[model samples]
Target: MVPLLVILLTLTGAWAGRPVLLPPPHAADLVLPPDQWFTQKLDHNNPGDDRTWQQRYQVNDTFYQPGGPVFLMIGGEGPATAIWVVAGQWIEYAQQYGALCFQLEHRFYGESRPTADMSVENLQYLSSEQALADLASFSAAMTEQYALPEGTKWVAFGGSYPGTLAAWYRLKYPDMVHAAVSTSAPLLAKTDFLEYKQVVKDSIYAKSGEQCYMNVQQAFADAEQLLEHPIGWRSLTSAFQLCAAFDGTSSLDGNNLMQILADRIESVVQYNEDNRAFSGHKDANITIGSVCELMNDESMGVPIERLAALNDLIMTVHEETCVEHRYQSLIDKMTDLDFASENNDATRTWIWQTCTEFGWYQTAEGAEQPFGQHIPLSYYIQQCIDAYGPEYVWIYGGYDQSFVDAAVAATNAKYGGRDLATSRVVLVNGSIDPWHAMGVIVSSDPALPAVYINGTAHCANMYPARAEDSPELVAARQQIGDLIGQWLQED
Candidate 1:
């Protein structure tokens, strides 16, 4: 899955002069509440470890009334922004129910640091189990601190990985959490997430026509063919605007380049037409339609040339100077343990979680996928080994697929995977969201309702209502609101 913060920042760009039918609340208009800190146990599992850390959080009580339900927006792999407490579909629900709202930053992300630096030993404390425990403790503390009315319902709202936590919170602490809205949450823990790419391919084909899919497939094929020769490699370097010349001999370079290209495409497909308010920016017209237009534009030259132009477009939007395809450069960045280094804390922390807990590695190995099969499953496993050390491999037994398989199996065993049986939880997935493949798109029980929005992308329902939103997304949000309301009315 794409990092939640990255998705927010990348997809939600400046309006770029696009007309807005009804503009959503901007950052300047939002009166963000002051940040609050709560002293939390460093290791809830270990009683012997008396270490404590001040976890960052924010609260918005504007619409709160006596005995109203509490809405907790759980933070995921990224920093928790105070804007979430003030602006979001959850905030609208808060207003309707007079609910008190809160957003807690996950430990080791943003300012909620549990250690001095991101050393491998320190990262051991950053597991999903630990995060769930954090939520439990935080909820109890909030109850006592606020002196909430007895049996006042508590609802959890989250998207992406935090959505997974929101659902699991209700499952793990049924008494503490009354209900949860899990949007685009991947319930399963798999090592080789081949389905991720397959969904990407499917989403492109579904959104764009068959011609667009064929064009993308041909682009990758052309890229791979060019990588076969030295002259072609030089041409690719010039065409793609690589920071360094493409190394044809190094499989690492080729793999990195291909993955970068696939990632750019995935980003567009994942958050296509998602509201820009989530990122606190005006919306840019960066949807699947725009991408397909670029891909199928004969005026932009052949498929490979159009592919290069697409990369350049993303680069311009992100303000990136040049694309870096060096494998060691990524290793160097991830290995940086300095807490002060930009993005070091989050990058390393999330990678550690994947290596130990959820192995949601998106690899392009299947033949049906549009992206080339250059990115092997071993490439990701090696990344885990490289980011951490031999200890990671040793802990799991060996340095092979079996090790990753065992890790993934343990996670799914602990949690019920897609078969997670829970009550008062709404599983929301967009038809175009690649992460939906691993999510609970269909529920076997009525208590565990599933809302599958057609022609939507990742976490589409979580954002504030937009005039441009499809009818399906609007209806999905209404269903989710009604479900939460029903849960609150329960004993």
Candidate 2:
């Protein structure tokens, strides 16, 4: 990840490079009359803001008018609904604190989809640099359009990947967005696949009912054999992807590896009737029973070899269609060993990266790169690390050893200035959340402990943030929000 070319505007004037503002380029779009409801639009831009490309935005709570401090919502992976459902919270927050709330869907999902045929060449334009630009423009436009307090601070709120983005907003556009609230953000300095790996390990070895431990162990061993023998690179890659696709999906029941393939993969995979909004569990679906039962492959499910063989074909074609077209170059390099370090484990070689083309292979002739943006996201972390200090941004792990080390190095505080805003972080884990464990605390400074929330569940907001009718939770959440306001205090 290259260091983000942060274009912070201290000028306090009309922006240059007027961005396009209107309906999306192509897609059956919907426009709702400004009302207090879930008004879904394919692509809409604020008429203000002059610094954006044909960037897209999804506006919520548009009816909340010209007075309050505006809140910009950042959605996580996939076209999520929390931005709207949580609108209830912001409604009150706005009324109480005089803040108006709204959210934008991330690239690659929903109406915010890139019009450029989803190829890497065009997708590279979708990098965080562009997103950051789009955000800045969006913020400025909103500020100008809403005519809120002359200096009403803009706040960025996100969880998971978007959580890291919020933290980044403070680091990059500190003045534009004076507040950031990041929940379960993985803002390490390096490309660590360990974060997801730990989830797999815990799901199999530590948790009950889901035999992920015994199951993955065997699959991993078999995968190792295939890697060594090279009967076909296809099976090995398939097994690896099968293991890596558990982040937002996996459940207490079984490994319906099928659904992981559906929600995430490029294929047109179908889902059972159940699909609901989740903050943490983006992949929560009706396939948990089958996914958990996948551990019993030897007894009742598809053979590991055959599953790998079949999945290799399915996921490969899926990637070719969804991921391949955009990130052709990245994908080509994905199979190579150029990026793999001797220090990195062989176990994680085939896993897909949310950060970089960690795979060492180069793309084949004529294939398109499906991944958007060439900006190594690591650069953003490094900027934070350099400016904030190694401890400023953290890589918390619950025994995801690989990820822990990678994250610490990637987002180390050694990148920039020394005036640290946040020097400690907590990697909270549900005691049973297979994503993390007690032994993996990278830095137990105690100022911020890697909290193992006992009896609480993994992806806490998956079912709770909405059901949070408890006055206790609401008051506690309010305190957190206020703290966020104070954290991004203007420099």
Judging by lDDT against the true structure, name the best candidate: 1
Encode model 2's per-residue lDDT on 183-231: one tens digit a residue. Answer: 3344443342223333333333333343534543454345334433434
Q: Which RMSD does model 2 reach against the true structure?
A: 14.5
Residues 74-137 of candidate 1 have per-residue lDDT tens digits of: 6777667776777778778888877777778888877789998888778878888898899889
Q: Estimate the TM-score of every prediction.
A: 0.93, 0.50
For candidate 2, the lDDT comes to: 0.35
Q: Candidate 1, after superposition: displacement of residue 406 in Å? A: 1.2
Clashes of 1: 0
